[model samples]
Structure formats: C-alpha cells, structure tokens
Target: MSQIRKKWLETVLKYKFNHDKPGSPTIWSPDLEKISRERIKEIQSEKLSVAFDYLYEESQYYQEKFKQAKLKPQDIQSVEDLHKVPVTTKQEWLVNQTDNPPWGNFSPLSHKRWTTDGWMMFTTSGTTTVLPRVFRHTQHDLKMWAWLGARALWAMGVRPGDVVINCADYGPAVAFWCLHYAMSLVGCPVIPCGGMNVQRRAFFINTYKPTVLLCTPSYALYLGRTMHDLEYPTENSSIRIIITAGEPGPGIPSTKNRIEGLWGAKLHDDFGCTEVAMTPLGYTCEDEVNSVENPVNVHLMEDAYIPEVLNPDTLEPVREGERGILVVSNLFSEAQPILRYMMGDWTSITREPCACGRTHARALGGLHGRPDDMIKIQGLAFFPSTIEDSVRKDPELGDEFRVELSKVGDMDRVKIIVEPKSAIPKSSYIDPREKIQEKLKGLLGVDVQVELVPYGTLPRTQFKSKRVFDMREQCY
Candidate 1:
C-alpha cells in the first residue's frame, strides 16, 4: 500500500475496530460467520413460523389477511411454506392506520402496552397526497441495527476513538436515530450536524475533524459544494471515511469516484430501511462491490427478525441471481412484529464465494431500486434513480434536480427540472437546457423536456428527498 493508504488503514484499525490489523487475511472475524444457505433457510423457517403465529393471533391486520388467504401458523412449516402467507404492502399498512388511526392493527399489542421496553414509535414522511405511517420498533430491533451498522463501519475502517460527522436529520424518522445509536455503540464520538447551518457545519468539521462523515450521497455532494463555497479545503479535513445511505454512492462507480475525489476520503455505501431496522446491507472492504460478493447477514439479532425475497406479482421465491422484492419479519418485536411484510425494494442474491470468506448471502448490486419507484411512459418502464445516475455524470449539473410526471392529453409526459452547478457559468449567451435534454435522451432513450430552474428554488428535504413529482396523481 502507498504511504497515504497505509496511514489511513492504521488510523482506522487503531481507533475504530480497536485492532491494529483489521484487513489482515488471518483477521477474519465477521459476526455472520455461522450463516450458510441451509442455516439461513432453517432460521428463516423457525422465525417465519413464530412471526406467523404471533401476527395471526395478535395483529388484527394480519389476522384478517390470514383469514383472506386461508393461512394457518402450522401451514408455515418451512421457509418454502411462507408463500402461503399473503404479502402486505406499505399502502395497505397506511390504509390500516387510517381505519384504525395513529397505530394500526399492525401494532402487535393493546394500546396500554405500547410504552413498554421494546416498543418505540417513528413517523415517515407523507405529502398532502398520503398520510404519514407511524412505524413501531422494539429495543431488540434497534440492537440488531447497531450490530449490523457497527460491523459495516468496522469493515469500512471506522475506528473507536475516531469521530464521525452525521448530518442526516433526526425526528420521528427511524433511519436517523438508528444511525446515531449505532455510532454510539461503536464507541465513536458523534458530531450531530443534522440541523446546523452551512457555516456552523464547516466550523464543526474544522473543530472536531471527524474521521468519518455520514449522510445521503446527495447531501454529501451538497456538503462538498458548501465547503468549497466556504473556502474550506476538504483535503485539510480529518474525514477519511465517507459513509452514505438513502441512496447508493459507494457502489455506483461514477458517484463513488466523484465523492472520493471531492472529499479526499474513502466512500462506503450502506442500505437499510425504517420499517426494518437500519444498517441491513453495507460494503466492508474496497474491492469492487460487485466483485466482493457476500453480505454481512447482519447477525439478524436472529432472535429479532428473518429475511426473504420473492416475486412481487406471483409471491413466489425468485431463483438465485434474479431480482425480487425483499420481505422481512421480526421475531422479538411484540409491540409491532411485521409478518412477511413486502418492502418494495429489489435485490439479487449471489451464492458465489466472497473474498471476505463470509457465508452470508449478498445483495448483488446493493439495492437496485424500489418496485414502486417505477414509472411507465409510452409503455416503457424506468426508474428515477437511473435518470439521476445519468444526469449526475454531467459535471455541469448540480446535485439537485426534479422529475415531474404529468399527463399531456392521454399520454404521460415526463419532464426534468435541473439546477446547474455554479461551475457552469450562467451567461446570457448559453442555454444549459438543451445540453440536459441531449444527456437525458442519450441515457434514458426517451426524450424529456428539460427546464432550467434557479439554483436553490427546489426544496431540500432532510429525510427522504422529494426529487420526483407525480402530477399525474398516480401514487401506487
């Protein structure tokens, strides 16, 4: 290794994992060492049966669903038998809250028992079109989150004494809180820059000089721009590991390269959800993510939850290497145990032996995209993530952009609103809209009207960024 890499690794090992040789070939001690395909399936079978019985008896929503599907706890004898249980959706869960209000039949307990040790409530964002669904979690669920998150950081080189800068907002949102809790468990001092102004953020980074920075990939780009504007040299910043979530960055080659180039730090990608606990998937080493196959298996808290993937429409398990919806059930979360809940996210499994020598199954490309994020125009289906990936490659464009879906006559009209980076000068003689149109066409294979919007006119959200607007009024 070069002098810089050697120094960075040394700092990481010394501070984060509390070890001097984290990446040594003989230093393999992952938490998921015991899970093989057979073991995973066996664990899934036991947990599914437990989840099914608990939900069928205690959860009103699942009780009704079980009756509708004619599923019995005994029917779910094996992981294969889990197919008999109907898959539940976020939309259905949202509607359940409406009928029941506040917490729904999904709440696995009487309201009197809600404030118990395991139960914790969180709120997700919903626009005027949808009502925010309040999610419930148990302390056991949170522990699983901490274990997976800490392991990912350890693999990514976060040392114990090193400070980590976190900017993701905290509210009723579970993602933000879970990450903060995870960093604390790792024994790292967390710098909460979530609500700080740009100047304050710069000051915090300068004062603390954290070894790791955590936030969404988009926000990380925004931070880089803000630092540049403030004349703060990122190279001088002590941040060596850049951890990003809410969207893929470390796995996406172009975005990863851009982030690392700008911050002069290593970028690590983490994937997880609010409904399920945070830190489900993450990259530990620097090998090309796709090339370094197996996942961390998350230790499962196996006592807390079980995981599986299936064909969204057919509800049948997909063959290995095929993409499918991710479904999970929690065993210890009596306050609100999700039984075979469909998460809408897609991931492919790989049986290929990982270089890390861990037996846990890996998500081939991290998260491909959410099944519900798909948009069909002119009979062609596409995702906003794909469009964003294409647009981000253009150095002239800013990280902020919006996708508007409206109906033009009987056809769906797709339009893109761009906020160009200041790097591209705003001159009376130049038109950036045409260049955006060309790039979108070349990348999406579809023509879209590109509108130039003033910088900062579009809103920035701390939780899930609303980059896409469905004016067509179709939210399914």
Candidate 2:
C-alpha cells in the first residue's frame, strides 16, 4: 500500500479500536454508540476528510466523480458539505462494472492487494437485470464487519452463552458470513445448518436446542410452521431469539408478530445492503422490541456512517421525522467506502436517544421497501411491504404470498395469491381469503382479487423473498 493509503487505513482502524468494546455486556462501544451527537459529528467530520482524500487519490471512479462535480476532496471536509457531492446510484455502479468488467474502479482496493489480502466477493441478486453488481472486500474489511456485527448483536441482547443456528445457504451473500464471524467473536457456539433441508434443520433444532435462530423473516415463519408439521412445535423449542435479515421483518408489525408468535421468540432484524456490507447499518434494539405503542425503531450506527433521508424526486434532504429515501455515506470499510450512496429504502430518522441508552439515529417504522419495489395501480403507488404487512396480519393465512399485477381490460388490477393455514380446512379458506382481501383493500386503497391456493402450494424462501410479479406488460 502507498504510505498515504496506509496512513488513512491506520487512522480508520485506530478510531474503530479506540471506541470498540468487544467484551462489554450491555453496550459494545459505549464511547461510540452512546456518545453525544456533537462528538459523533466531529468524529465523522474528521474521518470524512481523510476518507475523501484517500478516495480521490486511490479510486479512479470517485476521482472522476469529484472532477465531474467540480469539487475537490478538500471541499467535502465536513458532514455539511456532503450535499455538494452527487449521489451515487446502483445504476452508476452497474454501468461502471459493465465498462470495467469483473471488478469495478469504484473500489479503492487494487488488483495486487486484492490478490494478497482479499477476503470475499459478494454480488446482488440481479433478478431484474442480466449482470449483477459485484463487490470485493479485503481481510481488513472482514475484521471491521465482524466487530461492527458484534456491536449490533450485542445491542440486540446476544451474549456469549447463546448458541446460534444460522439457517442461510452460506452463499456469497454478506449477512451469513458477517453474522457467523460476529457470533464467533461473541463466544457463541454456531451450528452451521446451511445446506440442510427444513426437516433436517428442524431435527437439529429439536435435538440440539440452539438458543438463537438466524435466517430471513420468511424462512423463520416457514421453519416455525415446518417444525409444527414435524410434530416439533417451535413454541416448545429452546430458541429464544430469531435474528432476521435480507427482508423487512420487525418493521412490519404483522410479519414481526407472526414470526414472534409462531416461534415464541423475540424477532430482531438488521438492515444492510451489498455495497455497504461492512455491518448491519440499522438494527433493532431491546427498547424497540419491548415497546408496544411506538413504531419499531431500527437504530442507525451514526459513527460508522452518515445517513440522510432525501426526497425521492427532489434529491434534497427531508425534514427530520419525515419519510424519504435513505442515502448513506459509509465512513468505514477499507475496500469500498461509498459516499452518499442511495440505499433507496423509505424511512424517516430521529436522533432521539433510544430507551436502550444509545443516541444514534433510528429509522422509525423501519425500512418500508424500496422505490423500485413500489407498485403503482391506477394512480396509486405503494410498496410490496405494505401488502406483506396486511397479508401476515391474518392468523389463518400461510407464510408465503404472491402479488400479481395485470391489466384487466384498460384498468390495472392486482391479484393477491395466499394460502390458508395447513390446519385450516379447504371449506374454511373462503372466510380467511375474504378477511385478507378486506384488510388489504383498507390498507392499499384499492380492491384486490384474493386467490386461495392450497397449503404448501406457494414456494417458501430461504433468503430474500420475491413476492411481487408485475405482469401488466406481459398481459398487454
């Protein structure tokens, strides 16, 4: 590494270690997590200054971006000047990767360093497009991820004694690996049950009695239901906490309640993306989990990243406590420290100190899906999460659901496919379907056709669930 690059990395690592408390039971980093807002900004400002200089000197992609904006690295020395830098979008990331095949110039990690110190490479699902954007992280990045993940896990009340069972496929995705390392760091024994089927996973859970279950929210519900099918009731199981990621869980009350109700466990969720995969940027705290009246709050780690809520169209920062798209400027990460990357999640943030005593900003009501996932029907726009919230509210409905949008004559119509609980008789499906349709209509402000499928007919997801299928173009 160049001396300048080495110095920047050392400075970043020093901040991380200085504030980190790996062995703390209550707060992992009291100095960072519970520090005053002014101190947090000061640290961010200092880091931002160093980070911008490093990015300008190292990353060709960021260097060109700075040149195009007519702003030098010194212009963005503080958090106040972040607005001067143009927002980086996923589209730009995809285009850059296409132009510079394989690894993109967006990352500062050079080929030589990546060959020697590279840890892992992760990619987006690329469900809509042909080429998925890829990211390569270094060993230093992994260490940062583990430490940050440990902080998030600790805040969620995870301790050394808790045994965690990770139910992911152990794929290239960042969540499982990050959680695994964090679990190891926290001194928790992890049972890697990735490739196993639901039956086999249930067998392990029943026999081994792991204290914590880690998987996506949909899978948690499916697993809990499957446990019941296998005559191993989840309520009777020893799993006390279900930590979910990859999909919206605790944010949606119905989905959160359903999983928590089924597993007889507390359902906690952390929010992160492929680009900013160093840690769980937003996490559920104990206070948010226990509170019944206020909407669930996912605390944003302000010290690690600067989060801004911007209007989707105007691209301007929204007033505090107002809903807008989430944009983050990652101050951490050795390989890819992104600046003002649009995360595109609909959420409002509040810097109010959480009842758990952490003063970081909280994403009120959690992430409400992305703008790209928003479904427009007859002049009305709503997120798929809204439908999910309504679908999971009914106790008699199954865990899986599909929303199909088609053109009925000249009008846009939505059809929600849902399965009745296996325990419920086929004759009783009509009532639950009607109830779900009514609830959805009230929530979505549009009448939707509700289809009742047989139990186990809809496919369950192990990772992120794809529930919406817009067939309007195909129908036309």
* Best prediction by lDDT: 2
lDDT tens digits, residue span 323-420, model 2: 98999988888888899999899999898899988999999988877778889999999998888877777778777899999998998999999887
Output the TM-score of candidate 2. 0.97
TM-score of each: 0.82, 0.97
RMSD of each: 8.8, 1.5
Please state the error at residue 255 of candidate 1 in Å.
2.5
Off by over 4 Å in 1: 1-31, 127-129, 277-306, 424-436, 453-459, 472-476
> lDDT tens digits, residues 1-476, model 1?
23422332233222222222234332223323334668656755665665666666667788888888977656676677765777777788778888887777776666554566454677765533366777766665566556555555665666777898888765666655666776776678888876777667767787778888888887777777778888888866788888776765665555666677788887776666655544444353544332433322221223234556788788778998888878876544445556667776777666654565555666665664676677677778777777777677777766778998888777777899888777765773366778878877777777799987777777765545667788886633
Worst 10 residues of 1 by lDDT: 294-303
